[model samples]
Target: MVLKNLIRIRRSAARAEAEHPALAAAGLLPGLEALPNAILVLARERLAIAFANPAAEAMLGMSLRQLCQLGWTDLFPNADAPAGAIAALREEASGTTQLDAVLELPQREPLRVHAIIGSLDAAPGYVLLELVENEQKLRTDREERILDLSAVNKQLIRNLAHEIKNPLGGIRGAAQLLELELGANGGLREYTQVIIKESDRLQTLVDRLLEPHRHPHIARDLNIHEVCERVRAVMLAEFPRGLTIHRDFDVSVPDLRGDMEQLIQAVLNIARNAAQALRQPIAEGTACIEFRTRVARRVTIAKRPCKLALDLRIIDNGPGIPEEIRDRIFFPLVSGREDGSGLGLTLAQNFVQQHEGMIECESRPGHTEFRILLPLQC
Candidate 1:
């Protein structure tokens, strides 16, 4: 089906070239270069790419020169449905055709897209193919949910913290007063000391729960790899022997504007959590964590369109998150480990959201990944 469609496109291109030689040679329409969807034009003879817009280059992770070198088969290796739709358009009077298709770009995950194929009136010899990623809607919806959940968590934490704080202060003061009443060496002084100590511990917990609200966001231009390195150093220092930390950074990614300390703390919290989960692997000397950074183009975040974004991933080789708590990992007080404070991931999510970013996780036995997406241009 794809081959027959390619033949039809080639024949149409040949006819257009015969009718308007000059326009066919120009390859692309004037305004198509500025489009957000990945657009490509096929040549009159062999269905080779004659023109590719900037968005196409970004989507395919190639230069215009590189794309021109590929044939239709190279671009759509496992394509389906769209080819038949295009063939139908050629046979019928339809000016355009649309279908869902999978696009396999170089060294990237397979992209699901809604492909729109049509002919240009001015350059009829050329076939115009536009690809709009299907994940945009899903990403936007997920981001909205994250924002809503974060808002609810913030309100609940503030109210609960305040309620806990008032009683905690009173309890600590009353214990102090009682301790003084019974002399330092009195029989019950130790009991009063225990009460004061426990109160102080609870106060600390409350303070942590309210920390995100108390702190002001301070934005600065900083390199993401620097944050990764800082966290990597800390994790290595703490682990020292068995765990291995690796880096796969794209140095060309531009510096992002965000709160440096908050971002650092956010990444550190996740790394520390991963390290803690690697106890069994560490003992066997097979534990590994990798920090990878890349530039994502044409992404949607929090229902907003962004031309460019940062994709940072922290991947670990360890036992996966338990299925029972996996869905609630970011909820405060939820933990898979017995000794875990359960606030690390919650604080991490809050910090990332403050920078207009979102974090997503995927896990299975022996492989777990946390992806952080932050928009560079919206």
Candidate 2:
């Protein structure tokens, strides 16, 4: 819709150009600048950038003067589709064309965008290009799927836990009665004790699994940095000699309403996991974990849009998560380590979800980052 309106304005500018060419051109610029979508005008000769709006400047991470120094191919290096689209527009004199293309950036991931190209009637042999980022929509869709799956998984866990709790108690009680019947000095007492001890262990495991659902959320205004400090202290104490924890906080971020203890636990679980994964690095005296925070604007969580959000990242310089379990790290009973109980991330996710936040992770060979986004009222 925005593209259509901008195109219509260009046609109107062209129609009124005869007696008021300068005025028409002057009025068209403010309309483009006022728009939030990134727009760039390409010269027909070398396809060099003839104009760029403020949105384009921000999105492309370059000023109009800088953008003017580059051509379409420079901006989208080796992109065949966008090059073909420009070629067709010039040869056939097409009014408009649209395509999904990747825009390459310096030292950053390639941005996938929906590109709209139209002839600039106001300036012969020039075309206006509008770019709309597709990542936001894709992220929102992925969040929705995660939320849906989480709901189903949580319900299944609750039902399974309850079902296990009842029979589990009966089994434990039966073992106790058998133990009593056999008495302390009896031959079968050792086997009864084994049954009793194993049942108790399973009972403890079940309790941990059900703990998050049972705990009442206590909300209060809390500083996110304070929680990070607490987790850092705990992790450093555990891995004192080898590990170094760093803090990069946006102190300007305001306090948010949340369950402080739950937040601490969530952060600690992730940090502890990172510390454990950094075993080799720790032994080599090179282990590091960083707690970074920043303010994110115009963010979305669980399909709901927010004006502001707290972006908290826990990054570790260690061997990355094992690829096989990376995708299921947050799922219950899933763990990368052999002895891991596999409930830390699940509980962390649950705690964050209780405060209307979401957790996401990205990992490669030597870098792993866990990002938590919590919507802020401000």
Report the number of the highest-TM-score candidate. Answer: 2
lDDT of 2 by residue, 1-378 (tens): 989966754543344343335435645665776689998877777888766776787888886667777898887786678777877788645488898877778777888889898877666667778999998877777778778878988998888988988998999899899888877667788888888899898888888888888889999999999999999889988998988999999999889999999999999999999988999999999999999999999898887789999999999999999999987898889988888899999989999999999999989988899999999963
Whole-structure CA lDDT of model 2: 0.85
Model 1, which residues run further than 4 Å from truth?
1-5, 8-136, 184-187
Q: Model 1, 6: alpha-carbon shift in Å?
A: 3.7
Give each model a TM-score.
0.68, 0.75
lDDT at residue 254 of model 1 (Cα atoms)? 99
Clashing pairs in 2: none
lDDT for 139 in candidate 1 is 58
Worst 10 residues of 2 by lDDT: 11-20
| Residue lDDT tens for model 1, 1-378 | 978944644554454445546655665444666577888876434657877766787788886667777886677777757655554555433388787777776678878888888866656555678988887665566678778888998999999999999988999999998888888577799899899999988888888888887889999899999999999999999999899999999999999999999999999988999999999999989999999999999887776788999999999998999999887899999999999889999999999988988898888899899999999998
Candidate closest to the true structure, highest lDDT = 2
